[model samples]
Structures are given as structure tokens and as C-alpha cells.
Target: MSEQWVETTLGEVADWSAGGTPKATNRSFYDGGDVPWAIISDIQNGPLRETAKCITPAGLDAIGGAKKVVPEGAVLVSMYGSVGRSAIARTPMATNQAIARGVVGTQVSPEYLFLWINAHEGQLDQMARGATQRNINKQIITAFPIVLPPAPVQERIVEIIGAVDDHIAALDAEVGALQGVYRAATSLLWGTAEGDEAAPQLLGNVMHLDVVRTPMEAGTTYRLAGVLNAGKGLVDKDEFDGADTEYAAMNILRENQVVMRKLTAWEGPITVVPAGFDGFVASNEFPTFTLADDIAPGWMKHVCRTPRLWAEMQSRVVGTVQRRKRLNPDQLLLVALPVPSRREQEQAAEALDAIEGQVAVIRAEATRLRKARAGLLSGLLDRTIDIESAELEV
Candidate 1:
């Protein structure tokens, strides 16, 4: 550690204050308000521009004199539910009692402080108090230990971390755009005009449920696959114990096969099994399907993801309660689908595949960048990596 570096509490480097909520019974306090009022939900990994709810000046006054408006650049932390979540206020705002505002003083850079708090989230989580819903108080937050460096060094550190974050944000934006394109293409591919001649047929004619259970043997290891809700995709269920004595019957998932979580079919937990996950096992809750030779598995997966199909699946759900609702395979097979010619299906698949491939690459790059940033944060914050040397590279 350099001689110039010092260890200090957050209180020593910034002004500390807590926020409060106005009385809910009074309609005048919140109706047609101008002040942006923040809640714990408003605290994210980045700067907060606006909030879910707003408050009038009378509402602010009702919270009491101490809970004043927090200005832009002030670092705010959630002290109650979702403890340790932090963000910078991009605009003037006031928060509920669950948030603690740290007004950056001349001693420290606001960005540096925000990044440091984010990097040390585990410590904040450890400091939370209570039995039911864990929480931290103003005292705990203000007394939190911080490793301080010179203002110039802090600015350089922020520059290094901020660059990677900006890159990640850009990649995320591109991925979103690509996904929108894919959705639009799918809509075009499935659109039916008044005189369109695409044949409408039952799903059972094009796809069949692959329910052949490959029962687990006594001592053999098997990979488990889980379907993610909301059309996310398949994920390896590493948490499943294949060696458990009470293992149930599981169906084997093959490449290019479509899988759906029966319980969450309404919410769109359907996806095509990509290559390299060929032999994974899935429980009955996740039913697998094999498409006919004429149908493209990718296109079928997208069809299942559509809100129209999801509504049909919801109608087929059979259960007494909402959570218990499950889609019956027989009923699922009876759902209608518009069948296009083989040539058109292949062309649509190719277009969607191109967009999806680009999205996958960008997402993988984002993951790598996040890991690299985490490593840099740890090394720089702990003084394991020389700030001056890192600054030169940046």
C-alpha cells in the first residue's frame, strides 16, 4: 500500500442522511406531484433517472424536515429489502426510509465511491440486521470502512471500470435490437392475410411428444436439463442430484428437439434443444417434442414462444389453482398452427438464425467483459495491482 493511501469510514468522506415516506392516507401528498420519490426498487447497478412514484412538496414536508431532496450525483443505497443495491441519482429526487443517501464531498469522487460500494456488496449484505427481512441502518452504512486513495487515482480507477461498463451496455443494446428483429421476422413469417393460402393444421400433425423415459441406472452419472420460463432457453440443472436414491423417471433430450415446462407453458418456457446438450435428462414437468421432417425445430420453438400460442396453452391448462395449472400434452397437440411451404420455412429459419447467432456472440462477450471487470475491481481495490501501471495500460 502507498503511504498516501488511508483507511477511513464513509462518514469521514461524505455527508450521510436517511429518507422517509409520506403518509399514505392523505391524497394531496401524492396526487399530481412534481418531486421524484424513490423506493428501494429504484436502486439499481446504474444511475436512477426517474422513480416509480412521485411526491408533492406537501408530501416531502410530511416526511419531516430531515428527509430533504437528494441532488444528482449523490450515491444512494438500499438499506432494507434488496439491501446493498446502490445507484447514483441522475436527477434531483427524494427516497423512502429504506434508502440512505451519501452526498459526495470534495474528499472523494462520486463515481469512485459508487463503484467501491458496488464492489464491496458482500460486506454490506453481512452488515444487514433483522430476523425476517434483513436490513441495514444509517449508522452501519456511515461507519462502513473504505479504502481511500488520492482524487486523481480514484478518477483513473473509475475510468478503467467505466469503459468496460460502457462496452457491456452497448453490447446489451445491440442484443436487444437483434432480438426485436428476430421477433419482427417471426411475425412476418406467421402473418395470415385474408386470401393467404397457408394450410392451417393441428399441432399434433406436425409434432409428436417424445416421452420415452430413459430411466436412471443405479450408479451412472447423467446430465440434467431445465427449461427456463419466459422463452429464455435451456439451462444445465447442475443442482440436481443424479445419484439420489429416489430419482424419478426422466426423458432424454436430443439435439434439435423442442422442450416445454408444462407448468409454465402459459408463461412461455419453451425452447429448442441446441447442439452439445443431446443426452440431458428432463423430468415430466418439462415435456419434450420431436418435429416432423417438414417442420423446422427452430421455427416451431418460436411458434411456441408467441403470445397467441401461449394464450392457447393457458386455455388448455387443467388445475384448481393458478400455480397448479399444467398443460396437458393431448390438448397441446390439438392447438392449431399455420403451416407454410418448406422453402419459405427454411428461409425464415435462416434469417432468424443469423440474428440469434449474433446475439449469442455478443452475450458471450458481455459475460467475459463482466468477469474481467470483476477481477480488475478486486485487484485495484485491494492494491494487488498497481493503479499507476493499470492506468498506463488504460
Candidate 2:
């Protein structure tokens, strides 16, 4: 520890309190409410600016009235689900019992405390106790160890971290704007209504199920992949030895081939096998298809991600149990897909791909910035890195 730093318990620097939930059964407590009723999910990266739900003044009264209204600038910590997630309240807000609010003393900066708490989320979560939903109580929270430097140092630390945060926020905004553009472009390219230039054709006409199976050989290892629900794309599920396998064979995935999880096809567990996942294996539950020569790989991949296609599959699903429902290969082929000329399809794909490529680059940078922030926070708090030496541009 730095010679100028002081070690103390969190309670010594902040007055701690927990909030309560208003009576849910009482309509007077919530109906037509304006008071922001914060939950664990609302305690995100920065300030508790707004919440998903709200409560009436009667609801405030139910939760101890004026005392329950956490003041703006207070640091809020989630105690239940997503335990230890921390944020500063940008506005006065009421919270459920699962959140702990801390009003910092003159000696401490709320922003500093919020940053420290967020960085130590894993430690606090470890202190939580529960089998199903882990949680920390007032005793554990109040006793959490804190390293406090002088007020000015705290402000400096917060300032350095805040710059990185701002950069990340900007990058996120860029991704969002680019995504909106991509959505508009794809909507035009893949319109539901038939246009004079677009000749709609049955999926069966342009694609066929390719039931290529790879027999598992003993002593060989296989990399397995699974399609993410809602068309997120293929993800590495696991790696297993062929000797331990229960099945005699697994479906082989080829690059640019379309694959879908038969069970959740209605919910869009479909994607084109990207470059890196080529030669990966999946179970029979995931069916594969080969597109015709005229079909653009990028176009088919976008179609897999479209919600309209998913909605169409939903009505075609079969099975008595909702969870067990499946969209069979034959049924999937029966749907009519809007098809344009090869040139138009390729042009649309290229445009959308360009926007997505930009988004991916920005996102990668944001991730790097986040990791750098974590390291900087650790170094600053431990006094290993001098405050004056810090130069976080973003």
C-alpha cells in the first residue's frame, strides 16, 4: 500500500442501507406509478439513470416512504442475481430488497467507490451465500475491505477510468448505428412482399438436405459445434474423444453450408458454417443443407438471421410438446423465399457485409479497451502505477 493510503472497511466511509420491494398485489403501489423502481438488472455499467419498472407514491410508502428513496450520487450494489454489480445513481431511485445503497461520506468519492466495487464484483460474489441464487447481506457488504487514497487521488483514478469508459460507450454507439443501417439494407434486400424484379421460389428449388455423416473412429478427437438460438451463429460446444462417444456417426459441417438445430429451427437456431468452423461436427439434431450455385453465401447467411424467416418456421413446427417441437427438413423446404438476380443478391450481401465488418472492428477495440481498463484500475488501486504517470486516452 502507498504510504499516503489508508485501509478501512466500506462501512467506515459510507452509510449503508438496503431497499425494499413494494407490495406487488396492491395496485395502488404500482399502477400509474412514476417513481423509478430499480431492480438488479438496472444496476449496469454506469449510473442508475432509469429502470425497467416503476412504482407509485403508495409503493414508496409501502417500502418505508422517504427513507427508501436513494439519493442521486449514491452507489448502488446488487445483492441477489448478478450479485455485486455496482453503479452510481444518476437520479433518486427506489429499489427492491435485493439492492444495497451506499451514501458516501465526505472523505470518499462515490464514483471511486462505484468503480472499486465493480472491479471487485467477483470477490463480493464469492462472499455470497446460497445454493440456487447466491446473495450477500448487509454484514458482508459493510465489512468489505476498501483501500482509500486521498480524495484528490480518488478523483484522478475515477477520471482516468472514466475516459476509457467514454471511449467504450462511443464504440458501442457506433456499432448500434451501423447495425441500424445493416437492418435497413437487409430489409430492402430481403423484402417479404414479392417485387416485379424479385422472383420468389420455394426453398426446395434452391437447396437440398446433404446428410453427409462422418463415422466416429476410436482414439480420434472431434471438435463439436452447435448453432446458437436466435441466429447468433455457430459456437464451439465442446471437444470429446471418439472413444467416449455414444453415437456411431455425427453430421459433418462444411464451410458455407447452412445448418439448423432441428428442435429450435422455429426460433432461428440457423447459420452458415463460417470459415473457422469447417470440418466441425454436430449431432443429427442439426440438419445441414447445400445451396444452389446461384445463391450467394452471404445472402443465405443473412436469411438465416432474419426474424421473418423464423416466424414463418414457427407455424410449420410439429410436435405436441412446445419444447419438443421441430421444423423438419421437408417442412423447411416448403416455404417460399424471395430471390433476386444473382448480381443483385451479391451486391446486397456485399453492402451488408461491409457494414458488419466495421461493427466487428469497433467491437474488438471496445473489448481491448475494457481489458486495459481492468488492468489500469488494478494497478492504480494497488499503488504500483503512479497517478501522474497514467495516460489513458480512452
Kindly list the per-residue Cα lDDT of model 2 for residues 1-394, writing each as its tens digit.
Answer: 3448889988788766423333445433333546566655566757764544765565555664223335445676655664344333433334322222333322367788887877777787778787667676679888888888888788889899888888889999999999888877776555423444476798898889997899999989999998998777999978888888898999999999989988966789988899999999999999899999988888888877788788878989999898999999999989887888667778777888898899999999999998998998998888777777786343
Off by over 4 Å in 2: 1-3, 18-32, 56-67, 82-107, 191-197, 391-394
Superposed model 1: Cα runs more than 4 Å off: 1-3, 18-35, 55-68, 81-107, 129-133, 191-197, 239-248, 383-392
For candidate 1, write residues 74-174 as lDDT tens digits: 67765566444434333223422222233333246878888888788788777878655657766888888899888888888899888888998999999
Poorest stretch of ten by lDDT in candidate 1: 91-100
Instruction: Score every model by TM-score.
Output: 0.80, 0.86
Error of 1 at 12 (Å): 1.2
The lDDT values for all models are 0.71, 0.75
List the pairs of residues colliding in candidate 2.
Answer: 164-394
Lowest lDDT sum, 10 consecutive residues, model 2, at: 97-106
Candidate achieving the largest TM-score: 2
